[model samples]
Target: MEKSIHKDQVERFGSILLEIGSLLMSYGANSMRIRVTLNRIAKAFGYNLELLITHRALMLHIDDKDDQHSFNQLKRTSPHGVNFRLVSGISNMSWRIVSEKWSLDEIEKEIERLKSLPHYPRIIILLLVSLADLSFCRLFGGGMIEMSIAFGATFVGLFVRQEAVKKTFNPYICIFFASLASSLISGLAVKFNLGDHPEYAFATSVLYLIPGVPLVNSFSDIIDGNIMNGIVRGMHGMVIVLSIALGLALSLLIYQI
Candidate 1:
C-alpha cells in the first residue's frame, strides 16, 4: 500500500473521496454500491477508510499511514433520479482507479466528464414509456381500440411528467399532476365510449409513475442492513403511490366517469 507524504495530501484525498461519495448519492446510488465503491477507492489509494452511509448523508474517515493523520468528511445529499449510466460509469471508474493507479487530477477530470455526460433524450424516454404502457394495456387484455386509446393517453401523461421533471416541480406534485392528466384523459375516453373497457387503460395509465427503483432499492437496502436508508426510500415510494392514488381519485371525482 502506498503512503501519503504530507498531511495536506491526505486531507485533499479525503475531500476528493467525499466528493465522489456525494456525487454517487446525488445520482441515486444505493448505500451498498456507495460503500463498496468508496472502499475500493480507499484501498486503491492506500488508506484505511471507513464509511457511515445513510439516505441523507455520508460520513467518511480516512487514515493515512505515513503521517498517521486522519481526515473526516461528511456531505449531505438529496435523492435524485436513478441513472444507470452514471452508476455504471462510477462502478467502472472505481475499478479503473485500482488497476491504473491514476493521479487525483486525472480521476477528477474523468469524474467531471462523467458528470456532464448526457442522458438519453427526453423524447426517447417519452416514446419508450408510451410503448411500455401500451404493452401493459395489451398484456392486461386490452383490445385494439382500447390499446390505441391507452397509448395516446399514456403518451400525454408521460409527457406531463417529463415536463414536470424538467421544471423541477415537487415530486409529489408532479406525480399528482401527471396522474391527474392521464386519468382525466382516460376518464374522458370512457365517458365517450371510445373503446371496450376504457377503464383498463385509465387504471393502468399511471403505472409508469410508480417509483419502481426506490421500492426495489428499499428492499435491497433492508436486506443489506441499511435500515434507515431502506425505510427512507420506501417512504418515498409510498408517498409517490399515495400521490398517484389521490390524483386518480380527484380525476374520478371531477370527471364522474
Candidate 2:
C-alpha cells in the first residue's frame, strides 16, 4: 500500500518471476539461495514477494507496492541434472536486475537468452572423463595397458550416460547402466590379462558415476540452514552412488571374475 502499481501488469510480473524461479531451481541453486535471490529481484522492481519453496516445486505470491494487485503462481519442475554454469549465470542475472534496474522487457529478453543457453557438449565431457579415469589408473600403479583400458571403459560408459540424458531416461537408470558398461568393459583387462593391474581399471572406470556435485551441494545446503533440502539432496546423491554400486556388482556377478 505504499504506492499504486498497475493491476493489469500483475500477471506479466508473476509470469516473469515464475520463469526466473523455475530456471534457478532447475539449474540446481539451493532452495535458500533461490528464495533469497528471487525475493531481492522482485523487491528491486518495487514488489513484495512470498515464496513457498521446496526441492521440487516453487510456489510464489507477489504483491505490488499498492497492495491492490497481487498474483500467485506454482511452477513444477522435473528432475534436473546439475548445471553449475547455468546456476551461476542465473544468480548473476538476479543481481544485475537489482543493480542495473532492468525493466520488465529487458529482463524478459535476458531470461530468454539465458534459457536458450546450450549445455557443454557431451563429447567434451566424454573425453575429459576418460582422461580422468586414465589418470586414476596410473595413480593406482597401473601399467600402460590398464590406463588405456580404463580410458576406453570410461569413454563408453560416459557415452551411454550422455545418450541416456538426451533421451530423458531416469537418472537412477542412467547411473546404473553407465556404471555397468564401464565396469564390464574394464573387466576385459582382467579376463585377458591385458595389464599389470587390471583391477585398477575396473576400480577407476566407474569413478565417473560418483554424484560429487549433489553431495557437495547437500552439505552446503545443510550448513546454510536448509536442512530439509540438504537431506533430500543427500539422499538423492546416496541413491545415485548406490545405483553405481548395483551396476558394478551386477557386472562382476555376470563375469564372476
Candidate 3:
C-alpha cells in the first residue's frame, strides 16, 4: 500500500511538472530552463525525473530499475485532462510538430478534450496580443508620435476592455489603426518640418517591432546550452527582422513613387 501510494504521488507530481514545462515552452522558454525547472519541481516532490525535451515532445524517463512498472502505472493513472493540456501546450509552442511528431488527429482530439480549461483563454489571449503587436509594428515603419499614441491607446484598450479586446481585437485591426496613425503623424512631421529627422520619428516609432531583443535572447539561450530552443527562437527572430526590413523597404518605395 505504501509503495502504491509513493508511485501515485510521483506520477501526480510528474504530471504537474510536465504541465508547467509545456506552459513555459509555449511562452518561449529555453529547453535548459525547462529542464532545470522540471528537475526542481521533481526534487520538491521527492522524486528524480530523467527527462528529455525535443522539438517534438517531452520524454520522461524514470531512473528506477523498476521503471517499466512505474511507467505502466502512470499510463493507467494519468488524468486525461493533464495529458490533453500537455499536448495542447506543446502544439501551441510549435505547430510544425503537429503532423510530424504528435499526430494531428490526436492533437485535435486532445484540444477538443481540454476546451473547457481556464488557461486556454489566457493562451488564446496571449497569442492574439503577440500577433497584434507584430502587425502594429509592421504597419507603422516605427513612427514616433503616432506609435506613442498608439501604445497608450493599446494599453488603455488592454486595461479597460481587457476581456473584450482579448476576444475581439484581431491582428489586422491593430495593424490598421497603427498604420493610419503612423501615416498621419509622418505626414504632419514632413509637412511642418517639426524635427530634424522626420523619417527618424517613423523609424523610432516602429522600434517595438524590431527583433533585436529576441535575437539576443536566442544567442544567450544557445550560449547557455539550450541549443534546440535557441535555434527555434532565433529563427523566429530572424524572420521578424526580415519582415520589418521588407516592410520598411516597401514603405520607402511607396514614398518615392
Candidate 4:
C-alpha cells in the first residue's frame, strides 16, 4: 500500500512540474530560469525534478533516459487537462511571447490556449490595466483628462473584446493609439489657443511610447548574461521606436500638405 501511494505521489508531482514549466514558457522566461523555477515547483510538490528547457520546448531528465519517455507519454496523454494552480504563471508567459518577435499566429494560438485556463479574465484585466497606464503616461502630459481617458479607454477595450484582444491584439496598437490620441488632443489644444507650446506638450506626452527603457533593459539583461532575452527585448524596443518615429514624421508631412 505504501509503495502504491508513493508511486501515485511521484506521478502527481511530475505532472505538476510539467504544468509549471508550461506556464513559465508562456512568460518569456529563458530556459535556465524555467528550469530553476521548475526545480522550486518540484520542491513544493515534494519531488525533485531534473528538467531542461530549450527555446523550442521543455524536456525532463530522469535517472534513466527511458524514464523520460514515460514522462513525455504522461504529458501527451492529457495536454489540455493539466491543472494550472497559478494562473499568473501562464499570463506571464503570454506577455513574454507577445513582447517578442515570434510569429503572430503562433502567439495567438498560445494565448487562445491560455485563455481557456481558469482566471483568464483576471489576466486580461491586468494586461488592459497595464496598457491603460502606458497610454495615460503617453497622453495629455499627465493631466486629469489623460488619466481619465486612459482608464476609460482601457476598461472599454478590455471589457468589450476581452477574448479578441487576447487572441488578436498587438502591443504596438496600444502604443499607436496612445501616441495618436495625444497628438490629436494637442492639435485641438493648439486650435483653441489653450496653450502656446502645443508641440512640446504633444512631444512630451508621447515620450513614454519611446522604446528607450526597453532597449536599456534589454541591454542590461544581456550584460547580466541573459543573451537570448536581452537580444529579443532590445530588438523589439528598437523596432517600436523606429516605427513610432516614422509614423509621426509621415503624419506631420501629410498634415502639412
The positional error of residue 26 in candidate 3, measured at the CA in angstroms, is 2.0
Q: Write the per-residue lDDT of candidate 1 for residues 17-39, one digit (tens) a residue.
A: 88888888777778898899989
C-alpha lDDT score of every prediction, in listed order: 0.85, 0.85, 0.50, 0.50
Model 3 bad stretches (over 4 Å): 1-7, 55-57, 63-69, 72-194
- The superposed Cα distance between candidate 3 and the true structure at residue 53, in angstroms, equals 2.5
How well does candidate 3 match the true structure, expressed as C-alpha RMSD? Answer: 11.5
The residue pairs in collision within model 4 are: 26-93, 26-94, 27-92, 27-93
Error of 1 at 170 (Å): 1.2
Model 4 error, position 203 (Å): 2.2
TM-scores of all models? 0.93, 0.91, 0.53, 0.50
Model 2 pairs whose backbones collide: none
Tens digit of per-residue lDDT, candidate 4, span 140-234: 45554444444443444334334433555565655555555545544444345443444444444445456654576567667767687678667
Candidate 4 segments whose C-alpha is farther than 4 A from its true place? 1-15, 25-33, 43-167, 170-174, 190-194, 207-217
Predicted candidate 1: what Cα RMSD to the true structure? 2.4
Q: Write the residue-wise lDDT of candidate 3 on 1-257 in tens digits.
A: 88887666556545555555555555455567677665654444344577766543566754334453343112221111113354445445334332245333453454445444455465465445544643464464544454444344333333333443355654333333343344344444544655455554445433444555457758978898878768976886776656545544555555652
Name the runs in model 1 displaced over 4 angstroms. 1-5
Per-residue CA lDDT of model 2 for 66-149, tens digit only, reads 887899889897678777777787789889989999888998888878777897787888898899999988988988988999
Q: For each candidate, C-alpha RMSD in Å? A: 2.4, 2.5, 11.5, 10.4
TM-score of model 1 (CA atoms): 0.93
Error of 1 at 185 (Å): 1.0
As for TM-score, the candidate ahead, 3 or 4, is 3
